[model samples]
Target: MTTPLRSLFDFNGGVKPDYHKDASTRLSIGVLSAPTEVPTELVIPLHQSIGGTPRPIVAVGEQVKKGQRIGDADGDVSSAVHASTSGTVSAIEMRRMPHPSGLSSLCVVLETDGRDEWIACQAFDHKLATPQEIRDYLRDCGVVGLGGAVFPTHLKLNADRQGGIETLIINGAECEPYITCDDMLMRERANDIVRGVVLMREILGAKQVRIGIEDNKPEAIAAMQVAVGDCGDDLQVVVVPTRYPAGGAKQLIRVITGIEVPHGKRSIDYDVQCFNVATALAIYEAIGLGRPLISRIVTVAGNVDAPRNFDVLIGTPIKKIIAACSPLPDTNRLIMGGPMMGVEMPGDEVPVVKATNCILLGSNKIFPPPAPEMPCIRCGECALACPADLQPLELYWFSRAKIFGKAQEYHLFDCIECGCCSYVCPSNIPLVDYYRFAKSEIWAREKEKSLADEARDRFEFRQFRDVRDEQEKSARLAARAAAAAAAKQLATTDTVAIPNTEASTEANEKAALIAAAIARAREQQVTATPQNMQQLSAEQLAEISAIEARRAEIREQAKPHLPPDA
Candidate 1:
């Protein structure tokens, strides 16, 4: 191993709780016996990573081999899920998840066939493969942060903005009480962990590597040091102080490099990144052995006769391990992590997931309920104990009043929810609970606002479309009206433009000659008829009148029924 650094830095605040890991670390990692005769089923959830949830590819009643891919990664930021043991998929339905919320999630229930078989698997040469190929292989093999964050490992293998990773920190502190999975992994599989670390360093182009383990685990530190022997001058094992949350990625980075990464910023931005020891082992197994992550080391301690670490299969029931650990009669509750940061599981039958690191069984004596939450006295102890170095009292007040904006202004998101402030609060206040509540409310409001904004945008677009359509319709109608008017005007102009025809002139000349002839006839009758009819008496005149009336009727009947122009 390289020479250790002489100086170490300290994070602002942290609490040293009683590390109950001694009981679990007493024995080496034990393997759970496979179900050979008994009918046991494993309920594995597909949504196990920090980003997109995977989609199940295996159907119900399908036969799946151990380490066979059951769920495919959904998108760029997801991890695949594999079957833990050779089994036939009996049912694919919603099952109770191993979360504090007691919510149900989609799961594949595989009934073991007692044949722990495997599909084809071939190791790959990482040195020859491209960087993208290595990352894709790890993602498909279900490699993730096994330290409980469950962040997909492939996504974290990228280079920083500065172009390369400067320091790669491996977290072996296992600072949480009652959790010995990482410690046991480092002690037993230190060589594999180093191989994974070297692989990561090669991919990231890191200049140096630092494996930070708490001074409390002498065995792990010694094992890691020997495994890292002369790998390179840049790789070294540095023992950090035995402090609570020293295993925190940020805290460990600060302790090793004295670079305090701000909230909402990534460690990679500072050319440093961190991973868990178990995660490194999983990575090596994926690349070196071509074996996907189908199982993990889990610590079962607290209120149990045999508090031991077991290499348990994924999707194993919590009750199975509890039964093996011999849970005391007084064990009344099951928590899936250390007391300080673990969560109370919904029930004992809940299936294990990738995020589960430890199963801390609890009883009334082990973890009694906290004293009634008293009003904040502003004693300032919580601030001093906070590793994030934020004022806990002010945050509590803002959260209690439901002033989420104020809480955010106070940098509430920086709180890692490590529970140090709550542990040291003299007012017996559950400050972490308040912070979580505020955060949830804020998220809900943001989601609602987004939905409202989207709906409004859609509505506005519809209105604009309607107005445009109406204008188009009006323009079409006006065009038709103008076309009709133009046609009428064109007809009138054509009539005026036409020259006079010969037939029209003949009809006009005939009408004029008829009118002149009638006028001359009337003048001759008035002058010459009086001399011939001087001696004619009244009887002759009467007879003439009767003949004239009959002649007038005949002439009117004989005349043609036509207009003067025709």
Candidate 2:
């Protein structure tokens, strides 16, 4: 059985703005039919969530089924992207995104085949799956928080790191003015939301589940009460006072649980975690029907003849949504969300992504130009209206002077950019704009510093490598020279006399010649030519004369032949 409602708590500061929610929530959510004049092509940006951009898996000209995975999750922090309807992949290229910055991102453009066919899907039972398995399943289903932040839902469900979660705070407090998507969702699908909440309670193993909805949404409150009563769980629907910025995660946590999450500390550190009502319903859809997050309910309001909400596909252009609403002829500005925290679109041609909850069309009639910014009068009104209990005036001064460090020290990032300070500023100063500029500058400088640090690391490593290489080269050369020296020393020490290879070879040749000459001298006897004639026998002397005669004859013959030839 569910427990009684807990005592409500008050946050630091908040404002009561003119709630323009009735204009859109008066009627039930409208179902948009397929475009008749032209085929509605969905341009799903890969970076719909708050983490890394998903990689495109479907290429141009490839056929994709409705609910088919077109983009795969990039990392643990990212969510997957699926086709909104069965279609042919037309173009996977850069297209204008639905962000206030007016920059482009990689988008998968799919032209609907008009059949709205579906791929085979299997429903999942959370009881049968492990915690990690459920998380992986949610990641693959492209489920994320639909509450403006669009953070991946799987990461939020990781309670094991938090020493086990104590409570699960469901934020149904749609406190932002003119945003009725969540309010209407709770009213129409309260049972589904309760089921999703139960699933979350099971996932977190929390002692209790408290859904914080603003008291302003009575219909939603009644519907949720009925659903919870029927479910018979300890899910308590706590009604919080409707105030601007009460829907913020930390603020909602405080109002519901009476715990102020300190700056730089996550809510889970306090044994608590939070999720949005719309995000819960998305979780239910993902697990119950195996459906991926391809579409969402967008509230189209402000300066329109028929301000209503529509169940829009993920990639429908804002222009088509405005056309459906019959926007006023004087409409000049198209904002992607509520006026308090919404981003003004550069043009209506941008496609809606997961973070888009409201498309507020405004003109001079609805949102007149702001009063000229004046010098700060040192009034404390901005600080009084700040929900985070920050000194807006001090933040403004630091941000205006580009002194981002001081602004951060004053908890500028905790400001939430809720525009409460700006709304209450008497000087009409765009205090939120200054804060945003300061934050952006700080981020850019941090990025630059990070890159510089990486470059320095690489340079230092290169220098170390060069020194090591030089030392190695010197060592190798020294080793070679030492080896040669050792060889010479060994040769000198091992031999009695070092053999002079060239001199020894020459001496041996000379000795060999002398020996041969000596041998020839010993083998033959010689005598003087005049004295030897007396010693010669008569026959021998005659033979010698005959021999001389033969030699003279041969010489005459040779001389005649040689002269004739010449």
Candidate 3:
């Protein structure tokens, strides 16, 4: 077995909250990997990643097998979405997304056929394929960061720049309370994870790799070490202190590599890259088995009698998953992620998307409401606990006062919303919530500014086009007038010398041709008859002749008594 790394570094400021992971880790995920029973329906959301939302490729009533692409990746920046199981598309309509905003978005509702059939899968030969080809393949395969970020994985495979990545860090910290999907994954599927790590390292062309797990997960660390035994000397399993939010990419990188990546700068700039263990497993499956990501391991704990981790389909309803967990009474709300950073879902019926790592059922007993807000006494507890080394009090004050510019100036976006600041604040200011509000307002304003710029550009273009059209029209009129004046001068002036007899003959010939054309046109017009009249019956012809004769006889009689002009 590979030996764990002894050298380790530390970062400034982090809290050690109750992990609460043991409740779900007691039993293996195998019992709930694939439930004996199936969900009646799977409402797969089209937008699951950080980039553009995948466009729906399946129409209503269309049958799709498991792992079949139901939503095509929008662009290189996006990831594809797939049918969780064999099913018929019942609707392509708006459904509530599992987010803190409780917003509804486009979803492909599927009525399950209960077959759980899969589409044909062929492994991608990354050895023979180019980097761009591999990225495109993974994007189509629906591979993304599964450790709650849900960033399209193919984008991270890019090793084209950043002075080349020398280190690849696999994050198995799972630092959030009550979330053990990654921990369980490393414990059971370490071999598969190792295979994925090798693939990722090859993709990034990294020379060395480090897998960092919290010291609390001894079993996971042992299993991963055993599996990684013969990989290479460059790859090591590093045990890190179990601290809340240590699993943050930057924090984990700091603890393992001593690389302090700033907010704006990227880890790749320091020749380092990080991936979650679950994300590694996903990469392995995509390149090895060719199966797209249609399911994930989700921890359903808190306010449940028997908390467990389940391998849930991407679009399976949370309520359906909860039904299996024997939810305890007084379960007030359903949270879609870990306690620290997870969003309280709008409803239990919200289907799990790719970002869902845990389903934290909340109640007053489990997560009691905070006491009434109190004025801050300039306490530095929040600042002390901040892992990013940011001043939480200043951010809180600016956000509360609606001073977004000051908040942003204070590096508001750097806050990871880990809830550490809020957890430690004596005044119970809900510091993270205020920070989140400021960030959202800033984003909304930026979006508006972008839209306004686009509209202004369109208006200016239209004005320019109108002016251009008018200028062209004026130029055309001037040219036409000049042409007419030149023609008149040419006709009036003796421009060419010719014999009188020849000129006369030419003029006569032109007149004769004009006359002949006009006569022919007149003859054709006169001969043209209405189709109805031309196809008259014999009785209609006879009736017309009799009427003509009667009219003629009447005219003859009237001529006898009329004047010569009449």
Candidate 4:
């Protein structure tokens, strides 16, 4: 009897293109020699993965070795970066990078010394390390998905253990056209890849390990089967049907295990964790040899005299790789990865980063200029091809209208920009491009909202301070009034008693002196100028006499309270 259809969920809507695998799959991967004209500058971007950017550790003019830690992972999600070669840091500044928009990114530049010496490194015993320890070690080694995603591998491995992950899915399906680095690795280093898979199984405590390879590469499948012959029944090698994007973690998981990772959910939720074959091999290199991820296998193809796969060091310029391949006569478009998901390079100055898997130097003869884009006809072809099961036409309309909120209602964020919809569209409309536009608009609005929230917080804090100050001022005033009232009451209650004999004698003498002085002053004033006397009205003269009389009375009263000597 024939074997059952291997792939469980045969999701429809994928293109069958001329996969030029023979270009690099047949040739053994060769180690690229360091260029004689070593670049004085190396632009190493900080954000080489999906999570937080690594923090740079080296300063300008600092000397470093090939494996020296130039940048460190800031958090559990981030990945570290090691020096690709022994060199002095030339500059740490922003430069053009390998991105779709050709945006500038902060990069670390190095001037090579041609020594290629390694720094002191340490290897950890995988058997002795705890799950957390293994995760941290892998992160420090800068192990990310060698597949185009560049997701931190440690983050995927350290997913919730309580979820009870039972299966480890190893993706060996190099489905992208004109890419064969994974195929070469599987054919040559199957044993190392299996060892890496075993190590991951041990770290995750998985029950079964399933190695999925496309049927197109029978040689790789047979090679891997022989390598894992004695690995026991727990490790099984299965041949899956050849399908584009079958290597996607979610798609591969669904195809092999019939379990779909829910929207906004992880593969661990389905009791499965997927890892790339290259990533597995890198893990083996990291744990077994104590070597950090400073280089990777790159497939250089497309319109060249010779197409080959090379284990190229990180930070090697794209121009150098093309020159090594013997420059193409008619270069049309140069992309850093597969044409399906790769980005076009503005120039050849951009360096090969950790995510650089394949470099395609397309010629005009091989890849003709794309036809002019026409308006969408709303034929629903894009929606049918969307792997995420989204309405691409609606998203396209909302995105063109700049209505990001409405676009999000239809799950704009879920679009992976796989270009499957655009590929299948009859009108040749760039549907994924519209989705990207909506996503960026939403992100910009969110950033603005965050700034507004901060400003509001500062205003509220200022108002609170003003209210506190006013309350404190009122409290101080009340305290001062209470103290003054208490002092007044004390003064009124505490009185001095006067002796009767001394009081009478003191009063009599003061009255006599005052009477005599008043009589003399009155006589002198009457004989003086009549003008001065006339200037004083009847009310003024009466008021002055009353003040003089009151002063004499006060003196008489105080004399009784004074001592006998006074």
Candidate 5:
């Protein structure tokens, strides 16, 4: 009898397209020699992952090592960056980065010295460490998902133990076309990948370990099977049918086991935590060898003379990688990452970031140019192909009208931008692009709102300060009045006899001086408008003159009674 379909819990409705993964997977992973002249100017984007941007730790002209911390994770939801090679920080300024917008971002440029050196890295005793300790160590080592998302790996592994994660799924499904980094990694470093999975199992207290590989990569499957044989029955190697996007965390979870991760729920919620094969290798390198993630396997393919997977250092320039690959004549489009999710580069000056997975140089003949976008024809193909089961047509309508709030109401944030909708769109509408635009617009508005809120806070704080100052002035005036009354009472009780006429004259003179000062202060406080002053009417000027004259008379009356010492 034939075995039942392994992926019973996989959600219905997914697109299956030709995945040309054989280009780079045919060759074993080759160790890339450090470029003789590593690009001095590195463009490190602030957003290299799914969480908060890291804060730069080094300034211009500061020297950094291969594994030295250059930027730190800002909060619980951030990832850190390490220097790819020993180099001096040349600059920290905004430059064009490898993003969908071709936008400028704050980047740290490093001038490498060619000598690949490392800084001090701490290693933990795995046997003696607690779950929290393991998580902390992974965080410090800059361990994150190597499957393009770049989520901090420690956070995923540190799920609630009460949930009881029984199985650890190692995703070896390199399903993206023309990208074979993960496949090559498993074939070349299968033992390390297994060790990483075992390490994860130890940390998560997982009972069983399952390695899932697509049947297209029989070599990788055979290699992994051989590697796990030494580890015994706790580890099993399973081959699933080749399918596009089969490597997605949720898809792989469903295919390997019959457990479905509910909507808006994590795979760990179903007692499963899926990790990419490359990520497992990185974890093994980090924990076993006490090394941070400084390098990764990158597939350099498409319209190139050499299509191979190389273990390239992070922060390597795109120009350098292209130069190494030696693209064929008539090369036009240069995209970073896989063909489906990769972003086109404006120029070759943009340096490689932590998320640079593949560099595809597409030529006219090999890779046909994308056709012009046509209006949606309401075919429902996008909905059928949607992995998340969202209505792409509805989203397209809302996004075009700039109705972001309504788009969000339809669960716009759930879109992973996997390009399945666009891939299957008969009209070639670029549905994913529209969704991305909508999301970006929403984020921009949110940022503006935050800034406005901050400004309002500052304004309120200033008003509060002014009110407090006024209250303080009133309190001081009250205290002075009370003190003056007490002094007058003491003077009346004292036995120092004086002429009442002289005392009255002295008091009158003091009152005249006080009245004159108060009149001057009131005059300074009055702001006369040009119109009002010009059209001053005879009555207004006469009133001012009368007040002046009365003040003069009062001064004259008290002049004789003024004390000689006053």
Candidate 6:
């Protein structure tokens, strides 16, 4: 077994609040009960992870089996999309995404056949595969961090540029209130988690492995300890203090590894890398069973009769998942994640995806609407509770005034939107909301600037090309003129050197022919002038008027057959 860590480090700024984890973790994870009116359609968003959205591989009307690959990774930093259940591809179109903005994106609609059949998967022993081969296999398996970030796991594994990792920290802290998916996974599948940790250790070539779980989860810590006993002396379970936002990657990393991840830098840059417990479990399944990630255990809690966790398929509708919990009659809001970081769903029809860990049903009684935001009193409670050590009041002032540059200057992008600041604010100011707005505004302006730069570049290039073309045209004309002059000079020189009677006669004949041709062309050309009009007689003018009248009549007659104006 891995020797236990002799000591641990600590980070600054955190709060203690009601965990409410027991409501869901009291029971074991179970499969979701199919609703009486099972949803016939499932909208599977391709861009669930943090990179390029997976490209659709299956077309409409194509039959797909459970765990079948439906969308392929589009880039190195992307994850694959799989069929959560056997169904026929009905539509691949834009649908509302699960975000606060409620924007639309490309989603694969599957009409369930209700068979839930499985497609054959090529499960390989990860121990037998090379590290590179295993990484590629995990990428195909659609493995990603299930700790709400949903970042691709393959990219995280490959972040170690020097191939020398000091520690691999597994974040099992689950510090967010009402989130126990990781807590339960650690308790029930500790051995599997340990197995995944061992695999990660081997792949990363790290000297030590640390799984940090909060002290509130005594059972999970105990189970993980027992599991680690069976492994070698390279892995241990580090029980961290129970605090809100302690589960954050940076905070947990600092507490477990004594390393501070500098702003704009990654944890891997400091000789360490982190993964969630659920992510490690996914890695283990993908490597050990050759199974692609199709589903996850989601915790459904708050304002429900039976609040519990269920093994939910990825594309199952949120309405159906909540049906299992029997929401209270007063339930009005359905949040897709925990209260701190969760986004309220536009409707129940939104489907579950990789990042969905909790579906919280909030009633007026459970989560009453926030009190009218009071003016900030500069109490400094928000700053004291902020895990990132940022000034929430200052950010609020800047964001409220739309002074985005000032907000950014205070390191606005570093705010994790963890809700710690908003939670402790005595003024009930929606501090996190302001931060989010500021960040989004900054990003929008940056995007606009980028687009403007691109347009300017294209316009400048066009101008350059036009000037270049004009210069080339002028050079070509000048060269042709010079050639003609040179030819004339050569002919003069030849004529001066040798004068023959036959040549002179030929030249005179050519000159006479050219003059006659020019005179004939001038005589045949028609020119309009007042002198020619005045020369016309009265009879000729009358004839011209008659011709104009006939032309106008013809034009009137052709109006019906003419094409309409654009």
Report the Cα lDDT for residue 217, model 3: 98
Q: Best to worst by TM-score, what's the order?
A: 3, 2, 6, 1, 4, 5
lDDT of 6 at 393: 85
Q: Could you give candidate 2's per-residue lDDT for residues 328-419 as a string of tens digits?
A: 89988999889999989989889878899999989998899998999999889998898888999999999999988899899988878999
Show where candidate 2 strays beyond 4 Å: 1-5, 33-39, 159-163, 480-492, 496-566
lDDT of 4 by residue, 1-566 (tens): 11235545765455666788897776788776365545555667777888888999999999998878788998988899888888899988887888877888888888888877788767779787777888888899999999888999998886348644788999998888899988888899998898888888877878878888888898899888877885544687878888776777777888888886767888887789899999999998898878889888899999787888888777777777777777578887788888777778888888888899999988777777767888888999877777677898999999989988899898888777777887788887877778777898899999999999999999999999999999999898667555544454455456833334856535544554466569899999888865665777899999988998999999898875758697
TM-score, candidate 1, is 0.83
**Ten contiguous residues minimizing lDDT sum, candidate 1:** 504-513
Name the best candidate (by TM-score): 3
Q: For each candidate, what TM-score against the reference?
A: 0.83, 0.85, 0.86, 0.81, 0.80, 0.84
Query: Where's the lowest-lDDT run of ten residues in candidate 4?
Result: 1-10
Q: Which parts of model 5 have CA positions greater than 4 angstroms off? A: 1-7, 34-47, 59-63, 87-95, 120-122, 127-133, 159-164, 257-263, 461-465, 472-566
Steric collisions counted per model: 0, 0, 0, 0, 0, 4
Rank by lDDT (best first)? 3, 1, 2, 6, 4, 5
Q: Which residue pairs clash in candidate 2?
A: none
Residue runs of model 1 more than 4 Å from their true location after superposition: 33-39, 125-131, 159-162, 230-233, 473-566
Which 10-residue window in model 3 sums to the lowest lDDT? 29-38
Candidate 1 structure quality by residue, lDDT tens digits, 1-566: 55554699999889999988789899888887455522388999999988888999999989999999999998879999999989899998999999889999999999998888888888878778776787788889999999898999999976333556889999998898889998898899888899888877877888888899999999998889888894554678999999998989999999999999997898987889999989988888887789999889999999999999988889989898888888999888899988988989999999878999999999999999788988788889999999988998899999999999999999998988999999999889989999999999998999999999999999999999999999999998667555544454466565654235767434544443465468789888776675666788999988988998999999999999899799
Q: Give lDDT for model 5.
A: 0.79
lDDT of 2 at 344: 92
CA lDDT of 523 in candidate 2?
66
Q: After superposition, how far is residue 461 of candidate 5 from its true place, in Å?
A: 4.7
Model 6 lDDT per residue over 1-566, tens place: 54354787887788887778888988888776243333678888998898898999999999998789999998788999998788899999999877767788899999988877778876677567666776778788899999999999998876335665988999999988888889888889998888888878777888878889999999999999989897655687888888888899999999988898988899987888999999988988887677789888899998898888888888788888788888899999888889898889888888889999999999989888999999999999988888888888899999999999899888898898999889998889999889888898899999999999999999999999999999999998667555554454466675655345766645644554566568778876644344667888899999988998999999999887746763
Total backbone collisions, model 2: 0
How displaced is residue 61 in candidate 1, in Å? 0.9
Worst lDDT run of 10 residues, candidate 2, spans 31-40
